[model samples]
Target chain A: MKIVTCIKQTFDTEAKIVVGGDGQISDEGVNMILNPYDEYAVEEAIKTKEKDGGEVVVVTVGGDKAQEALRYSLAMGADRAVLINDPALEKADSHAVSVALAKLLSDKEAGYDVIFAGKEAVDDGAAQVPSRLAAKLDLALANVVVAVELADGKATVTREIDGGTEELEMALPALISAQKGLNEVRYPSLPGIMKAKRKPLDVVSLADLGLSAEDVASKVEMVSAELPPARKAGQKLTGEVDEVVAKLVELLKNEAKVI
Target chain B: MSIVVCAEQRDGKLSKVTFEALSEGKRLAAASGETLKALVIGSGVAACADELKKYGADEIAVADNEALAAYTTETYAAVLAAYIAQESPALVLMGHSTVGRELAARAAGIADCGLVSDCVAIESADGDYLFKHPVYAGKAIGTFKISGATRLATLRPNVFAIEESDGAGAVVDFAPEIPAAKVTVKAVNKVSGDRPELTEADIICSGGRGLGGPEGFKLIEDLADSLGAAVGSSRAAVDAGWREHAAQVGQTGKVVSPNLYIASGISGAIQHLAGMGTSKYIVGINKDGEANIFNVADYGIEGDLNKIIPALVEKLKEA
Candidate 1:
């Protein structure tokens, strides 16, 4: 069994968002880390390898700084990493990213038994890459997956839906996106971190993957980006507990009309 | 050219978001002077055609088949992609839902077009359609313009209004070839509750780690019952195993914008705020007066949630 996990680097969840004068999001002074959801995918991939006696390889599409995210995955027990970085990908939309990934995975030598990815990246929250990649590669896909079990060349997956969970079964060579509650991720150990520094990490350009600027050109253009309006300061109610509760209820009914 | 709205139905009932999508599609079509078509694909879903007509769709196409009784990404994407290929609509609309998020991208990929998901607004400026959506987990907004012959977008639920107008349209039967499913559905386990879904709820009552334990959710449930609202939990509460992940509200969880949001015993992490910050009116009840939840709340009650929530529940019941 061979497993491939896709990951991305995003601003730290606690980082403040700022739009610069250039109409672009400013990354200055912002701490960047591997996306939180991708951690779950990496963890699940490694766990599957540990049990199934195979290798876990991590893949990412970003700039030179993305190697930090690949190294983080390596430190978590992935065998190696592949980073596809190029100027053509700077403004790539979900379609372009998927095309690049499909090119890489479609190579004759890049045989994979299963693929894993986070349900969505926190930065864009597009939640389209996995499905789009699956479509391009013609692979079975299960999104927002919580539990998975492999047996007899088939995988049973449970995913979260609108009001409940749905169970599905797919053959091997399928793609699964990790949702939260899939598993608790483990922290990289000191020995693992030491070994990760020596792990093989290959950085390639889009041209190396048989893709050109025209091939992966973004279909969607970013017209503009801006920060949301700041929320107004709230009115604090102070008094006896019962009085405040009564006042709040009245306001909800008469003022807000929500009740 | 026409605007095509994919009407989603489950177990023979059309979803509320479908109506919202149709309403938006109708407006966009009227603005562009194009036809509006509603496509319904499911087992025994032809009955939805009449309802689509009432919502101002100029044409309704139903592809009723037993194979589509349960949603399999491949089959549904194939069906929708084939429809788009034949219709060649200028724009396609659907609800940004579990099914929509899973199907729209694959359909767009097959149709070889551009897609924007979870859009809060769609506007036409100088004859170009601009899609505005929250990026960086609701901390910022990004406006996108698709440079494609045909574009697709998913409208966030509850953000768009649903309007009804008496419309006469032709009902057509579409018989696109459904592809073989790569995945098979085995079972479905629905959460047992009559409360509205978090995304569709008009009001929501949420709990956090400050509630102490899973038992504390009892109070939150009582409050929600009184207001006919949905129940939500902060990531801390879900991580602590006090609530299911489905009920979690955060950047990694569900993003919602209900009419009223009550945050009890929540200290409001930035991630949690990213999910519910856009809600219309927020009420925070926490012991810490300086909790971050208070910053974005419309009304703040500084006290113990254990006492305040129960009192508020009683008052709501009376009101």
Candidate 2:
């Protein structure tokens, strides 16, 4: 088995997001980490490689800073990592990113049995890349997958739907987006971190993939970015429990008209 | 050009968000002077076309096929992309659902169009559409414009209102050339619950670690039942094994914007707030007065959830 997992670096889930004056999200003084959901993808890929005896290659598309994410994946047991860094990708949308990834994965020399990615990136929360990539490559895809098993050149995956779970079986060379409840991710050990420093990390650009900036240009443009309006604290009920409950119900029905 | 709404159905019944999307599609089409078309794809979803007509879909297209009985990325995307290729609609709309999130992107990719996911608002300025969506896990909002002939988007559930209007309800039989199945469905385990789905529910009652254990969910469920709300859980509760991951409402879980969100015993971590801060109204019940949940809540009740939840349930039942 040869596995490829796509990962991204995003702001910490708890980071307070601020939009700068230039209509861009300011990453200054913000903590960046591996996207929480992508951690599950990396962990699942490593586990599959450990059990099935294969090479796990992690890939990402971003600027030089994204090398940190690749290094982190390397520490987590990915055999090697590829960072598709390019200045033209600064304003890239999900489509542009997917185009670049499809190009990288389409290389016949680096053929793969399975591809994994986080269900969605926390920063943009687009959740579009993996499906788009799979479509561009004309491969089977399963999103929000929580369980996966492999046998006989095929993969069985259990994914979350609206009201329940669905079990799916796809042939080799399929793509899956990892959802939560998939697996418990392991923290990198000291030895693992040391070994990662020496692991092979390749940095490529759009030109290197035989593509120009125009070819992978973003179809969507961000007009503005701003923080959500602040919510003010409302009435606090601290009186007797029974009276408060009644008052709350009355408020909900009469004032809020929610009930 | 026309505006197309992809209506989703399960067991021949249209999802509530489908109606919402139809309503939005009608408004967009009226604004653009374009036709409003609704597409229903499934094994026995021809009946859904009637429902779409009632909700103001001028043209209802049904792609009834056994191959589309269950959603597979390859088959559904193939059908949708083929439809887009044939119709060449200016805009495509669907619910920001599990299926919609995957299907829209795949279809957009196959059709080589632009897609914006989880849109909360859409505005037209100078004949251009601007999509407003949350970024950084709902902490910030980004206004975007798609630079393409065909633009696709998924509207977040509950953010758009549903309005009924009679249309010509013209039926169009669509023949889709579905590709050979690359993925096969083995089984489906549908959760047996009478409560409304959390994402589509107008009212949601959520519990947290403060409730102590799994037994505490009984109180939450009772409250949810009395108010006809869906049951939700904070990540702590789910992590503690008191609830299913599907019930979790947080950064790593489902993001919901219900009309009313009642959170009990939840401390409202930033991640948790990211999932539900956009709700129209938030009610927090906690023993600690300084829990973060109170900051964003419209109504804060400082008391033990054990006492407040049950009392609220009884009061709601009487009302």
Candidate 3:
């Protein structure tokens, strides 16, 4: 059973986003880190490998800068890292990226038992690539999984819904997207970080995967970037709690009519 | 050219978002002089065709079967992919929901198509469509164009308006050849509560770290029940373990745009605002008058929420 995990390099969640004069976002002076959600996938992959006596490999689709993200996963106990860095793939939409990933991993011929990824990339919030990749690879897919139980080539997964949970059972060679609370992500030990520097990290391109530019071209083209409309300030209602509630209810009934 | 609107259902009832998708599909189709068709899939859902017809659907395609009663990723995606491959519609649209997010991606893969998810707005010009969606956590917006022959996108709930019109009300049956499902749904653990889903709620009442502890949620729950609103929480409350992460509203959590949003004891962090800023009306209540939440709130009240919430709950009950 070989475990492959997908990771992404994204701007820190708390970083202040700046728009450039080119009408695009400015990543300058912003910290880049592995997507937080993917951290859970990395942890789960390592734990599964430890329990099942297999190897964990981390894969990513981004530019040269994404190598550091893969390194972070390698330090977390993965045995190998693969980076898909092609200028043509920059800022590619989910559809294009997933296709490239499916092609790259399947070409490995490893017969992977499980592929893991963050449910949604925090930067784009697309949340589509894993499922699309599953379709491309013709594997069973489950997203936002909080719990997973593996036994005898079968995987039982529990996904979180709005008000409850949905449990599903699937065969091996499946894809499971990680959500928060799946497991506690462990920091790399000093020795593990040193060992990661020598681990095998391979960089592949469109040519390497035997794919043409048009075959993996992004159908979704980004047009422009803009900020949302700013909210306006409103009057403050000053009074006791009781008076405030009374005034709010009055406003709701007569002014807004939402009640 | 035709636009296929995938109608979603649960427990033999159509989702409200299905109508919203149909309405938008109709408008887009009219702009391009194309046909607008509704595809309703489920068991015993033939009656949904009449409702879709009222929503301006030129034709309705029904795929009713026992195997389609519950949503399975493989079964649903296979069925939809086969339909798309056969009909070759110019565009496919569905709600950006749990099922839609998973199904759209899988279906796109099966057909080797393209998709843009969580679209806030859609526009058509000269047979080409543009989708507006938030990137970088609502700090910036990205407008996308799909040049492929077949395009797919999922619309955010509550963003598109629902419009009704009279149509031919024609019904067509579509039999999808479903392959053996690789996955099986064991059970769905439903939380027994009358509250609406947070993402789909028209009104929301949220709490934050100011609530102090888990017991403080009683105030929010009571007010929410009184107003018939869903309960939400800032990431602070969820991180503090005072509330479940499912109730969290922030950049990493669910993005919701409701008609009215009441924030009790929650300071307006940019991440939290990114989720709920699109709400039509916002009311902020906190002990500090200088909280950033007041900046975007339509109305601000300076006080402790523990006191204000109980008072508001009582008032709402009386109303």
- Which candidate has the top score in TM-score? 2
Candidate 3 docking classification? medium
RMSD of each: 1.3, 1.1, 1.4
TM-score, one value per model: 0.98, 0.98, 0.97
- Using DockQ as the measure, name the better of candidate 1 and candidate 2: 2
Best by lDDT: 2
What lDDT score belongs to each candidate, Candidate 1 first? 0.90, 0.91, 0.88
Clashing pairs in 3: none
Better of 1 and 2 by TM-score: 2
What lDDT does candidate 2 reach at residue A81?
92
Question: How would you encode candidate 3's per-residue C-alpha lDDT over A60-162 as one tens digit per residue?
Answer: 9998888888998999999999998888888688888888898887886358999999999888888889999999898998899989988799999999875
- Candidate 1 per-residue lDDT, tens place, B11-117, comes to 88788899999999888887888789988988888788887888998889998889998988898898899899999998999998988888999898888789999
Candidate 3 residue B95 Cα shift, in angstroms, is: 0.5
What proportion of the true contacts does each candidate reproduce? 0.85, 0.89, 0.83
Candidate 1 runs further than 4 Å off = none
lDDT by residue (B121-154, candidate 3, tens digit) is: 9999888889998988788888888877899999
Clashes of each: 0, 0, 0
* Candidate with better TM-score, 2 vs 3: 2
